[model samples]
Target: MSTPGGQWRNRETFVREGDGIVDLLTCKWAREHEYRLTKEVWAFRENRIAVHFAYEWHDEKGRWFRSCGNENWESDENGLMRRRVASINDLPIDIGASLFHWPQGRLPDDHHPGLSVLGL
Candidate 1:
């Protein structure tokens, strides 16, 4: 999850599948206003995948932010992620400068593939 100061933290246990879902829910709740995310696969081999992602959102006071990150995921035989490590950086952006223009949800298939396409 991300903090108000732009720090990321592993606040939930990943010992069980349910725990991850709960953590996601909690994190979403913590972020306010028009959250949109896009992720692209960077590489993959066997049970591991590397991804790059960017998300745009606003705070309660309508301050906009763009967060970019890279994640490494390791999955079990069932294709469930067993381990995930992420490094992220958040930058404040003006609303007009934001790149994620989709409505507040999943990006459409026709949207740009990743941050590189948008030069984010």
Candidate 2:
């Protein structure tokens, strides 16, 4: 999703182990205003799918903020996200860093968060 007034109509999705290319666009739910995935780390364990990701967003006032955490996603044979349970941490970055993507030609700066260096 998205914010009530942000109008985040553009988006893309990537399936695991599938090219890793983010060219598939799907934004039917773009008007939801209050749901999204920020830092997704996932894996399969037996019959379940586990996920960990950070969620950062803005309030109705347009103030950007973040909450970091992990989650559990269970699916049926079709591999769809279902029955999600999660926990959230309220800690924001102690350092004011500019998050970036170096692989996309963004250069390293003193404020870099290093996610790009780790190939995230």
- Evaluated with TM-score, which candidate comes out highest? 1
lDDT of each: 0.71, 0.40
Candidate 2 clash figure, as a count: 2
TM-score of 1: 0.77
lDDT of 1 by residue, 1-117 (tens): 221222222333233345545666576668757888898899999988999888888988889988888888777676666666677788999999988777767689885556787
Clash counts for the predictions, in order: 0, 2
Which regions of candidate 1 fall more than 4 Å away from where they truly are? 1-21
* Per-residue accuracy of model 2 over 3-100 as CA lDDT, tens digit each: 12211111222233212212222232232223333344567785466665544444445444445556665554555443445555644332244142
User: What is the C-alpha local distance difference test score of candidate 1?
Assistant: 0.71
RMSD score of candidate 2 (Å): 11.4
